[model samples]
Target: SATLRIELSRPSSSEFTFDERVNRSHCSVSVTNMSQQSLAALVIAYSILKRRRKSEQKRSCWVKPWIMQQSEFSACSMLAKELRIEDPLQFRNFVRMSSQQLQLMVELLGPIIGKKDTKFRTAISVHDRVMVTLRFLASGDSYNSLQYLFRIPTCTIGSKGTIVQKYEVFPDTREEWQRHAEAFNVQWNFPHCLGALDGKHIVIQAPANGGSHYFNYKGTHSIVLLGVANANYQFTYIDVRCNGRVSDGGVFQNCSLYDLLENGSASLPDHEPLPGRNMPVPHFFVADDAFAIRSYILKPYPFRDQPAPNRIFNYKLSRARRIVENAFGIMANKFRVLRKPINLSADITANIVLAVCALHNFLLSTRDSRENYLTPGVADSEHPETHEIIPGNWREDSTSGNSFFSLERGKRDNYTTSQRDVREEFKEYFMTPSGEVAWQYRHIV
Candidate 1:
């Protein structure tokens, strides 16, 4: 073998050695022989190649806009499109600000905005984004789904954390909601009407803690209550915190509206008729039979002999009242979240419901114009005009009575039936053949 020399270098006090040898070029290299020098060269080359590959991988981490996949950009674009709101600040410039209306609302909701120092904060934290987030929640889109539509960061918009705290700080009380009713009436061509009241089921997830409390006879977990919508289909009142077990009538009885009417706490401003009605006006609202009929709460007349006129009035009222139903339908349809089972806490769920109603009103108000479903047209003489009214003379049996009737008796004193009689009459009216009623009114104009 050729003469061989090995030099061991250990900088620290250790038995392990790193060998070094003098190469043909007189350069010091770690090796055992010529073959070892060849191996060392290959190891250095491999190390350099590995380092370059890692650098390339790091560069590839950031995708270029052009080379970026469509799926990635689509997610962001779709969200931006949905959340895009017409410049409200720009809208403020052209639309005259109604100071009186704002003042009225402020007064009604004032108590809820109790003395909280944090209300005046200038920073735009997640708390400050409540209104926008409420709009998203009301719309019922996933957080990622809404990310591109609204300017709000996706991170802040959907989190349950403090999302509703702002609303608690700026609650819209019953009175404040009612103030919008007049504006809605004027816009929708309804006269002397505050709002249309009706009930709906807000389905919720069966609570882990309160399963029996939310269970309803309908075989689902739901909170049943009423909502009052103005002529333009804006919510003036949303009474949703009731237990799922309560009846519509029971819920209405305990509602703030009932309290206001019963206690005379609700002040009716002297009805000044618009230029058309020469006399002082009266304020009134449309309600279904679930509520007690009052001067303010107009109900359909019970069935009577030749109940045509009462039927006509009921038909008109129904035509007007359909707005609330349509409003609820649109809300549930657009914000698919409302259609699905809500799994949030009761308080947050209530706020979410109200916020959705408010957003519905806002969108309706801001649209180019609302389509009027009820065009002024006369009923065909050949086609007998059908009217469903509360019936008279069926007052003796109140309980277990027919639900349908003609309310021909205009006077309030005439509405008398024992609770039993009322129920019996309701059953009879409910069982009455629609064909028979149509045949009876077939000739009446």
Candidate 2:
């Protein structure tokens, strides 16, 4: 009788045979007919060959040659370095921010947008990512254009919620609301005013099979950016993604902000009398005729058949509402993305608008950027002594094909009697010594 067993170990195979019938003899056999060390060497040689083939294949397909040289030849690397070292003004124009401001933003956003480097390749720097996004916004160029310029693949920038929430803050406290009101009173001579509200139509490509949901009266597809701007031209409250077909009043009625204001939960200050007036008035937002008049909101009297006092009130409201218009103007001027029909999806376009609004506030936070970004005559300015209006550069392009269009006026009958009374009170106040500005009469005339 014979028993056979086979064992394989360390790339070598051995067979053992035992015979018990005659003398219990034992014998050993080698399965490969080669020395154990030789078999082990052959196995090791085969593994090395296979690994080499895989390594060569990976090297051939890993990344494009131009992409690999991004550190040295990329537009972001070359142009940004030269502009930063040579001409800071051009650098500001290039990135829509100063070097210092860009560095500060990078530091703020680094930890959140930062990526861990892997063994195969290094992660993209946060600064580069920001620069790419800003360039896209500043030029309104397509992702393909940006990829060629920045030497990066086409991708959307992320982590915008932090910046949007931090900078574009609504006035939620009494003090904050009073701060805006005080600014309006001092600058625009409108008291008890929290902000200037309006809607801007941002053109976009027609959605696939969307029909008339995004179609506007202008024969284009658009989404509305409803914003309330403070006296200093910073957005305090913004509602985006509203359908263009809806009237401004309809959009306002549908927004959560309208509910907040109507329910007295928007954290507005208590009703207070105008300066030198006895009537207690609620703090309200000033809007255009496109918006419906409410107890907490005010619009101008009709354009036709207005008396002197009503005209004066309308002029004053127009002056205050100019801030919101200027806010949109300056933003569109600086970030040209809004100037053209954004070709991205509606969701991405909304995110882009929110991001630009946040950056608009961020750039205004510092004195240098504020002054440089919105230099004299860049935005509508009031003469300190004469109180004359100096039209901004944005006005030069008001009729340009790229600029935004005004919202269609809503139904005039939508206002209530009490809302009309509020307007009348303002009309009466504007003609009085308390709320009247000396130049208001000149403008009205």
Candidate 3:
């Protein structure tokens, strides 16, 4: 074996190799019998490698030339501008909002998302930021795809959750609740109803170290989006990003809305008599069997073999509850971002869901866009002449598949006397002339 010696030394520029100085190994082999020619070749090789590393560290350009031409070539600059002038329908299809609506959004969110320019470069405009965000919401395209289409950096575009305020769509006072109640009574024949309550699973990527917290009965990772919608299919209140493992009843019980209602700070209207009836009933939301039988929550009577009165009650309750379902369906069908598994982090996914919910309400707010946004037969409709249920276009597409799924019904628990009494009152009212509809019997059969 050749004898080896280790020598520790501080680096001298021409003496030690780059690895030894950077790695701080501080030791070099000194083979006394090695040829001088071999040592000279090794030093030359190290010098070449060091030179190559420095060249590789240099950036090719500050910004790509194509990115610099975004003002002229970007989708927002070209397609959006052209559509804003020539075709409004096509513009809504592209950005998921009318041009006027887009501008309004910029005005509303400008202060929050706007950035100030630095000496090095100009900040992205608030209008451009909103446009990019809307495109992300409409298409659910990856950030890389958005970067090239919008000519914005991938890091700059994403859905922000800062806009999910309930006061924008939800009722805040007894007067507001009364208005919603009137709408439900007129539209769905459900008296003293505030809105429809429901929940759907929003699939998301498994989070790091999440274990089974985000896992659901469907064998996928998800979060729940529980919402309350008025009769017109607009969301009034939404509790987003509840753990998928929890039942809808559990999620509702633990949410802030429930806390407020329990504390009597939710501004719920006092119990009032049903239309044309002497008995007063609590104002409540209609949901499916997945929820509890609370005084404020009216779920349909379980089991299909119910008596005639019970079946009629279920039919009417389902008709009212359909608003929330159709709200989810129309959203998933239009936005399409909700149709597939979201690959973002849990926090970002929550923000995206909330953003779309806000966008849904915003789309409904505009008189010009509202009619076209929810056109005739786009959502489930009742035949004017025959009263038959005509499935919406969304229902046809939903059959293909989507991330939207219902929660499993929770185990039956003994309901309080008051809860049981509320359901019975509604059941009895459906048989009365005031609550009964000419077509309800035909539809129930």
- The clash count for each model shown is 50, 0, 0
TM-score per model over all chains: 0.49, 0.83, 0.85
lDDT of 1 by residue, 417-445 (tens): 44333323322332244212333333335
Q: CA shift at 191, candidate 3, in angstroms? A: 0.8
* Model 2 C-alpha lDDT per residue in residues 1-445, reported as the tens digit of each score: 2323232222212333222221222233334556667667666755665564445342335667777677788877899999999999999998889999999988888877777778877777888877888888888888888877887777434332333426866877889899999999997889889999888888888899889998887888888889999988999988886988886668788777899988989889888767777777788999877787788888877756788888888888888999998998898889888888888667877888888898999988878889878967879988887688888888777543533787888777566766666677778888888778777777766
Clashes of 2: 0
Candidate 1, backbone clash total: 50
Candidate 3 structure lDDT: 0.80
lDDT scores of the candidates, listed in order: 0.47, 0.79, 0.80
Model 2: lDDT to the true structure = 0.79
In candidate 2 the C-alpha lDDT for residue 242 amounts to 94
Q: What is the overall TM-score of model 2 with all chains considered together?
A: 0.83
Q: After superposition, how far is residue 216 of candidate 3 from its true place, in Å?
A: 0.7
Residue pairs that clash (backbone atoms under 3 angstroms), model 2:
none
